[model samples]
Target: MIDLKALQNNFEAVSQKLKKKKIDAALLELLKEESLQLKEKRNLLEQLQADQNAKSKLFPIYKKEGKDIAELKSQLDQNKEKITAQQEVVRLLEEKLSEIALGVPNIPDDSVPEGSDEEDNIELKKVLDTPVFDFAPKEHWDLDSNQEWIDFERGVKLTKSRFSVLKNDAARLERALVNFMLDFNRSRGFDEVSVPFIANQDSLKGTGQLPKFEDDLFKIEGENLYLIPTAEVPVTNLFRDEILTADELPIKLTSYTACFRKEAGSAGRDTRGMIRQHQFGKVELVALAKPEESDQVFDDMLSCASDLLTALGLPHRLVMLCGGDLGFGAAKTVDIEVWLPGQNRYREISSVSNTRDFQARRAMIRYKDGKKNRLVHTLNGSSLAIGRTLIAVMENYQKRDGTIAIPEVLKKYMQ
Candidate 1:
C-alpha cells in the first residue's frame, strides 16, 4: 500500500512516479476523496460520541436532584442508536480504504531508468566467459534424454506436462545443488528457512501476487489458499503485519521452496525444457531495510547470486529491468542470465529486485522510530532458480561421453 497520507500530501510527485506504471490520475484522486470522506465521518462520529457522553453525565446529577428523567432517558436512547449506525458506517468505509490501499504500487524511484518492456532493459556487465563447444552440442532436453535422466513422458503420466522426473546423476546433482546454494547463502548472514508451500489469499496479496495476477496463481478450489509462485513470496511475507525494532532493520532471509504457477497468460512459450515450469525449486533472498539501505542491499543480493554462478564457472551477464518489464511489485529489478553452451546464449538463471517499501506497505510491516512508526522497505529475489541452473550445468558441463561434470563448488555437497 502507498502511504495514503504521503500520497495525499505529495500528490503530484507520487502521481508522476506512478505514471511510469500508467496508473490513471482519476483513480488516485478517487482514493483521496474516499480517504478524506472516511476521515471526516469518523472524526464527526468521535465528536458526537463525546457530546453524547457529556449529556449522559448530566443524567446522574438530574436523578440525584429528583428532576424529571423521562426526557433525558429518551435522548440517551436516540444517541446510542445514532452511535451504533455510525459505527457500522465506519466499518464499511475502512474496508473501502483497505481495498484501494492494497492495490497501489510503490512509487518509482527518480533514478529508475524508464522505458517500456525488456528490450529497454539496460545491460550491466558480463561475468566470467561464455564456453565454446567443439562438438554438435545438445540442449538440456536432448542431453537429459540421452543420459536417461529426465523422463518427461512418465512425468506427464504421473502429474501432467510442466513436470518431469530426474534420474541418476541429474537427480543427485539437483539435490547437491540445492544444498550447496543454501549453505552458500547462509554463510553470507542470511538466516535460512523452510516455509509453507501454500499461503492464504491475504499472504499472496501482501506479496503482490493476488488481485491483478490471480490468473498466474495456482489457487486451491473452494478455498482462499494458493501455492506460492516463488520462494520470494513466502520468504518476504514472513514479516507480514509485523513491527520490528529499528535494530532489526536489515533482516535477511533465504528459503528453498517448490514454486507453482498456473502460467495462464504465458502459453506457448518455453513449453519445453525447464526454462519455465509449473513446479520448480528455487533459493530466494529476502530483506527488510531502511530506505537508504535498500539499494545497497539489492546490490549485495545480486553479488551473492552472481558469485554462486561465477564459482560454478558459468558465464553470465546482468541487466536492469525497464519500467514496462519490471515485476508488478518491484521498483527496479536486475536479472542475471547465465550462458548455456549448447544454446549459445545467455538465459535468465536469477533475478534480484528492490521493491523498497512497496511490499511493506501492503503487508503493514513497520518499525518504530522513537515516537513514530514508519514502513520498512522490503526486497526479494531469486538468488537462483534451481531448474534453470541445472539446465545450464547440464548443457555447459557435458563431456564427450554424455556424462555431466558436477561443478567443483557442488562436489562437497554431493558427498
Candidate 2:
C-alpha cells in the first residue's frame, strides 16, 4: 500500500510517479476521493464520541441540582443514535478505502530509473561470459524428454499444462540446488525455515495477496486457505502482526518450497518449457529490516542471486526493472535473466525486490524502538528458480549428441 499520508501531502508529485509505472491515473483519483471521505467520517465519529462522553458527565449534575433531567436524557439518546450511525458510516468508509488501497502498487523509490516497459528497463551489465558451445544447443525438453530425467507429456496428462515431473538426476539436482542455496544463505547469517505450503487467508492478506490478485492464487475449496504462490508469502509473514525487539532489526530467513501460481494473467508466454510453469521449485530469501537498511538488503539479495548463477557457470545479466515493469509489491526490483542458448536470448530466473514498509504495514510486522513501534521494511526474492536454472543448464551445457554435462559446482552433489 502507498503511504497515504505522503500521498495526501504530495498528491500531484505522486501522480506523476504513478505514470512512470504506467499505472492508471484513476487509482490516485480514487485514493483522493476516498481519503477525503475517510477523514470527514472519521472526524465526525470522533466528535460524536467526545460529545457522548461529555454528556455522561453533565447528566448526573443536572439530576443532582433538582433540574428536570428529561431534556438531558433525550439529548443523550439522540447523541447515542448519532454516534452509532456515524460509527457505522466510518466503518463502511474504511472498508471501501482499504479495498482501493490494496489495489494500488507500491510507490517506486526516487532513485529508481524511470521507464514504461521491459525495453526501457536499464541493463546493469552481464555477469559471466556465455559458454563457448562446441555444438548447437538443444532445448531442455529435447535433451530430457525420453531420458526419464524430465517427463513433460506425463506432466501434462497428470496435472494440466505447465507442470513437469523431475526424475533421476533432475530430481536430485533440484534437491541439491535447494540445499546449496540454504547453506549459502545460512553462511551469510540468515536463518533457515520450513514454512507451510498452504497459508490461511490472514497470511495472504497480511502479505497483500488477498482482496486483489486473488485470481492469481490457488485457493482451497470450502476454506480460506490458499496455496502459497511463493515462499515469499509465508516466509515474509512469519513476523506478521507482531512487534520485534529493536535489536532484532534485520530478520533474515531462507526457505525452499514448491511454489504454486495460477498464472491467470500470464497468457501465451513461455509455454514451451519450465520457464513459466504453474508449479516450480525455488529457494527463497526473505528479510525484515529497518527502513534505512532496506536498500542495502535489496542490493545484497541481488548479489547473492547473481553469485548463484556465476557459481553454476551460467551466463546471466542483471536488469533494473523500470517503474512499469516492477512487481505489485515492490518499490524497487532487480531481475536476473540467464542466457539460454537454445532460445537464443536471456529469460528471467529470479527477481529481488525491496517492498519497504508496504507489506509490513499491511502485515503489522513492526519493531519496537524505545516506546514506539514502527513498521519494518520487507524484502524477498527467489535465490534462483530451480526449475528454470535446470533449463538454462541443460540448454547451455548440452553436447552435440544431446547429453548434458553437469556444471562443476554441482559435480560433488551429482553422484
Candidate 3:
C-alpha cells in the first residue's frame, strides 16, 4: 500500500508522480474526498462521545438537585444512539478508504522515465554481445524438435498449455541453472533460504499480489493459500509483521522456487516456448534495507544478477523500466533482458526493483529506529528465470547439427 498520510498531506505531488504510471487524476481526487470524509466521520464520532461523557458527568448533580434528571437521561440516551450510528458510519468509511488505498499503486520514483509500455522503456547498457550465427538460428521450439528435449504435447495432456516437460539434457540444464544461480548469488553474500511454495492471502497481499493482481495468481482451491507467483512473495514476507534492529537493515536472501502464475491477461504472447509458462523455476534475490541504504543495495543486487549472466557467458542488456512499466509495489525497477538470438529480440530474464517501503508499509515490516519504528525498504529481483536462461543457452550454444553445447560456467555442474 502507498503512504496514505503522504497522499493526504500532498495530493498534488503524489498524484503527479502517479501520473507517470498513468494513474488518473480523477481517481486521486476521489481518494482524497473519501479520506476527508473518513476524517470527518471520525471527528464527529469523537465529539459525540465527548458530549455524552460531559452530559453523564452532570447526571449526578441533576440527581442530587432532583431536578431535570429525566431530561438529562433522555439527552444521554440520544447521544448514545448518535454515537453508535456515527461509529458505524466511521467503520464503513474506513473500509472504503482501505479498499481505495489497496487499489492505488505505489508512486513511481521521480527519476523514472515517463512512458506507457515496454516499448517506451529506456535501455541502459548491453552486456556481452549478441552471438553471430554461421547458419540460420532456430527458435527453441525448432531446436527442440530436432531432439527429444522438450515434450510440449505431453505437457498439454498432463495439465494444459504453457506447461512443458523437460527430458534428458533439457531437464538437466534446468536443474543446473537453478543450482548455479542459487550458489552464484549465495556466494555474493546473500543468505540462501528455502520457502514454502504456497502462501496465505496475507502473505500475498504483503507482497502486493492481492486485491489487484489476483487474476494472475494460481489460487489453491479450498485453501486460503495460493501458489506463489514469485519467490519475492515468500522471501520478503519472511519479515512481515516483524520489527528488526537497524543493524539488520540490510538483510539479503536468495531462494529458488517453482513459480506458478495464471497469466490471465497475457494471452497470445510468448505462447509457444518456455518464455511464458504456467510454472517455471527461478532464483530470486530479496533484501531488506534501511531507507538510506536501499539505493546502493538495489544496485548491488542488480550488479549481482548481471554478473550471473556474465558468468554464464550469455548476452543481455539492462533496461530501466519506465514509470508505466513499473510493477505495482516498485518505486523503481530495472529489467535485465537476455538476448535471444533465435527470437531476434531481448526477453526479460530478471527485474530488479526497489519498492522503497511500499511493501514494508503493507507488510508491517519495520526496523526499530531508536524511539520510533520505521518501514524498511525492500528490493527483489530474479537472478535469472531458469526456463528463459535455458532458452538463451540453447539458442546461443546450439550446434549446427542440432546438438546443444553447455556453457563452460555450467559444465562443472552438468558433469
Give all TM-scores, in the order shown.
0.93, 0.95, 0.94
The Cα RMSD in angstroms, rounded to one decimal, for candidate 3 relative to the true structure is: 2.5
- Using TM-score as the yardstick, the better of models 1 and 3 is 3
Residue 54 miss distance in model 2 (angstroms): 2.9
Mind giving the per-residue lDDT tens digits that candidate 3 earns over 335-388? 999998888999999999999989999999999999899999999999989999
RMSD of each: 2.2, 1.9, 2.5
Identify the superior model by lDDT, candidate 1 or candidate 2. 2
* Candidate 2 local lDDT, residue 141: 69
Candidate 2 residue runs with Cα over 4 Å from true position: 57-70
How many residue pairs in model 1 have overlapping backbones?
1
Residue by residue across 248-327, what tens digits does model 2's lDDT show? 87888889998999998889987886788889888999999998888888888888889888988889999999987888
On lDDT, the leading prediction is 3
Clash counts for the predictions, in order: 1, 0, 0
- Candidates in descending TM-score order: 2, 3, 1
Q: Is candidate 1 or candidate 2 better by TM-score?
A: 2
lDDT head-to-head 2 vs 3, winner: 3
